[model samples]
Target: MRLTVIGCAGSFPGPDSPASCYLLEADHEGRTWRILLDLGNGALGTLQRFIDPLGVDAVLLSHLHPDHCMDLCGFYVMRSYHPNGAAPPIPVWGPAGTAEQLAAAYGLEDMPGMRATFDFRRYPDAPAGQIGPFSFTATEVVHPVPAYALRVSVGEKVLTFSGDSGPCPALVEAARDADLFLAEASFREVDDNPPDLHLTGRQAGETATAAGARHLVLTHIPAWFDVDTAEDEARAAYDGPLDRARSGAVFDL
Candidate 1:
């Protein structure tokens, strides 16, 4: 399995980072399976830079926030107008209101060419099921909107993605024993203004330690925060391999 960080910015996009998006690819035999964790703002273009836009087989949304799901419109356009127009609809998986949210985002209950463009599937808070080579479980998180952190297992390797959330036990349990934990360290400890929605670097590290994750990759950090200092704070709490995520960073698992 290969994990690619297409974007890793917080709240809004930064000059250097786009937003929140991760691509996971698994190759078995001669077949390839592609999955996207979140398609945040401007991630469609960023995705084109790494892999073919049509190559994506499935999209899983973490939440309805613009920074997490706004790029589906761009993806719709690509699936509708690209030279390879006959491509099959990609399966979109997400939390309960996913279908409605996509309809509202595009301003159409049944938009033109939408049925032909996407095979939409709404997943509940429980273990939904499998998609190709991966199986996953979703747990609700504490966020303004309905959000879920996913635990994905491909073969024997497991990876957890904390979309965006405050420090919560659901996240810790969902990521337990994960080979790689991609968590959000969206704010510095001192900058805890809207304190209940995002996690600080220290909080993220503690979560990683408690989950027993082999490696922790801190993401969703604002551009203004000192990256080195945030990493140091996490290191103080987590003794495992800890690192700050950068745009375009790729991990092979």
Candidate 2:
């Protein structure tokens, strides 16, 4: 599987990167299967630089925050109004009421809203879905609104994404023994951070340490925070292969 970092900015769009969007691609049959982790602010424009929007096989949203799923509106337009023709509806897995929220955001009627462009499906708590060669597992994480920490596995290789979360057991459980853990280190360790919200750089590293993740990629740091600070804090807690996620960064496994 190939992991491409489309955006890594936290909470909102940054000057250099978009919000929180990731692209995962793997080979299935004779073609490549693609799935997007999130479609955050300013991701649509940047996404086309990597792959054609029509080639997206599925989109898995971590939550309903504008910074996490807002760009779906722009994606809906491209898929619904392509010059060649309307693109086929692709699966969109998200939190409960995801369909309603997207519909309201795009100002669409209740019936067939963005559903015409996207086949929106709510993530099931017990049995997660499998798409092509990937198996997805979503664990509820501590956040203001409904959100999840996602673990995607292809055979033995695994990639875990800690979608905006504070210190929690579920987050650790979701990332257990992951090959690559993409953690959000939005808040710094020195700040007076809140609970059940976001992770500090040290906290992100601690989670990676506890989960026994092989490689840790610190991401989702807002422009206000320095990546060096996050790396310094994370390095203190974890002693593994670590890298700061940046736009256009690619990881192959």
Candidate 3:
């Protein structure tokens, strides 16, 4: 399995990267299957550079926040009206009412609204399922909105994504024994921590340690914070292989 970082900026776009987006791909039976973890603001355009936007097999949205899902509007435009031909409906797994939230984001009526370009599936019903060669499980995390963290496994290799979560037991469970933990570090330990929204770099490291993750990749560092400082904080807590998430970085597992 291969994981590609499309964007790593938190809350909004930064000078170096866009919001949050990650691509996970695997090969099985002589065919490659690709899935996108999130499509945040400014991510769709950047995604086109990495892979054909219309070629992704599926998309899994962490939440409805603009920084995490606004690019779906632009993606809809691409899949629905590509001059050559409209792309087939792709499976989109997200929270409840995702269809309505996306419709609102696109400023459309209750009818149609991206349903033509994407097949929307709400989570928790079949939270643990298979997508091509990968098996994935979703668990509710401590975020202000209805958000989830994902654990995807191909054979024995596991990749866990802490999709916009604070310190929560669900996160720990989701990341247990993960090969790589793509955690969000949007807040600072010294800053006035908000309630049930984001995690500090130290907290992210601790979570990785608690879950026994092999490698830790700190992502979602907002532009306001120093990236080096966040890495330092995480290093103080985690003794494993640690690195900050950067656009275009690729990991093989």
List clash counts for every candidate, in order: 0, 0, 0
TM-score of each: 0.94, 0.98, 0.98
Q: List all candidate RMSDs to the true structure.
A: 1.7, 1.0, 0.9
- The lDDT of each candidate is 0.85, 0.93, 0.92
Q: Is candidate 1 or candidate 3 better by lDDT?
A: 3
For model 2 the TM-score comes to 0.98
Give the per-residue lDDT digits (tens) of candidate 3, residues 127-176.
87788998998899999899999899999999999999999989999999
Candidate 1 runs further than 4 Å off:
110-113
**What digit string (tens of lDDT, one per residue) describes model 2 on residues 22-93?**
999999999999999999999999998999989999999998999999999999999999999999999999
Runs of candidate 3 with Cα error greater than 4 angstroms are none
User: Once all C-alphas are superposed, what RMSD does model 3 give against the true structure?
Assistant: 0.9
* Model 1 weakest lDDT span, ten residues long: 108-117
Those runs of model 2 whose alpha carbons end farther than 4 Å from true positions after fitting are 125-127
Q: Give the TM-score of candidate 3.
A: 0.98
Model 2 gets an lDDT of: 0.93
Descending-lDDT candidate ranking: 2, 3, 1
